[model samples]
Target: MAKSNKPIVWGLFAAGGTVCAFVIPVMILITGVLLPLGLFGPPEASYESMTRIVSNPVVKIVLFGILFLALWHAAHRLRITVHDFGIRNDQLVARAVYGFAGLFSLIALVTLLSF
Candidate 1:
């Protein structure tokens, strides 16, 4: 008998899903809810509001974390969908898809932060 790492993989996935689901909705809420409500100081504070919210070091870190996790999650689910549809040579396809997903996600993150 041998101890295996399968459970660890599954646990990591569960954690990722749980955290993304929770954090993503909150991110949406803050952007969607408070922005409309003008609760982030004032209605005139449009760019000011965004700069205030995103300028915090902690918020930048968290946004980057969420963006990467979201891309990884999307890539994984899309890979499975391709596999489940009986696409031929799915493992090879999954690898290519994920590699591009990661590369593009990094590019997008960099582009976003430059603004």
Candidate 2:
């Protein structure tokens, strides 16, 4: 018997979801580790520490990449989620959801660049 291809779509979705699951927690852990280690400086760290954190070229680039990918991932997943819930009304909803996600992502990128 030949295997069906429909399962492939589900598999891809699962893979993406798994990545998201891991990415979110791992990012959180990094933040926790770095903050306590004073990568952003001590609890008493002043504006200087915050400034230093934002000034690193590598860190800024990585942050921008992560932000863009995360937002795109979120929008794609949310679109599927809304569809799964049987809200088959129009394409507008999906567009709006993805559009808003991208817009916010761009805003974050700009803010990060400035800092």
Candidate 3:
């Protein structure tokens, strides 16, 4: 029998896809549509509330998870898309896409923690 890492990648892909499909859109709506429209509160109040949201450790972790999963999901999608576009070098493509994902994920974690 042979072991492969496909299961792990596929697991993250599935979970990330679910997160991207569901949570990310709502995030866009809240941050994009509602925030600018003053639906959350007065502008100053919203800014203070948002600052408070990031200062809390729990929210930071949640944001990290959302960002990390989204980045992973997009990287996987881009890898597949590049292959579909006739890029025959799988190893190189895999490393590039996943490398960028990892780098950005680390950046996201650091940025979140800084708050």
Candidate 4:
């Protein structure tokens, strides 16, 4: 049997999906609903507060992980979806989607490290 690296990608995809399921809703509630509606106290949603939050090394790493994994997850999902949509070129689609994910992951890493 030929061993493949698909497991690694699948693992990332699963992790990303799990994180997104748990985190995105809370994030939307906080940033999208709570802050804008002024239901929370004193509006700690300012630029400075955001900057401070992202400034912490731990927070930066977590954010980067979430962003990178989410991108990869989306890419893999799109690739599978394309295949399901009757695309016969699996190799080409895989390359394009994973390449896009890698490129964006690099960009996110650079951006996060810059901050």
* Best-fitting candidate, scored by TM-score: 3
| lDDT of candidate 2 over 4-26, digit per residue (tens) | 96475455446556666767777
TM-score of 4: 0.79
Q: How many clashing pairs per prediction, in order?
A: 0, 1, 0, 0
lDDT of 4 by residue, 26-63 (tens): 88898898778866556555666777878899998998
lDDT of each model, Cα atoms only?
A: 0.73, 0.71, 0.90, 0.87
- Native-referenced Cα lDDT, model 3: 0.90
In model 2, the runs with Cα more than 4 Å from the true position are 1-22, 30-47
lDDT of 3 by residue, 1-115 (tens): 6999888888888889998898988899999999999997998899899999899999998888988888888888899999899998988999999999999999988888888
Better of 1 and 3 by lDDT: 3
> Residue 55 in model 1: shift from native, Å?
1.4
Off by over 4 Å in 1: 1-12, 29-44, 108-115
Candidate number with greatest lDDT: 3
Residue 45, candidate 2: C-alpha displacement in angstroms: 1.6
Error of 3 at 99 (Å): 1.3
Q: Is candidate 1 or candidate 4 better by lDDT?
A: 4
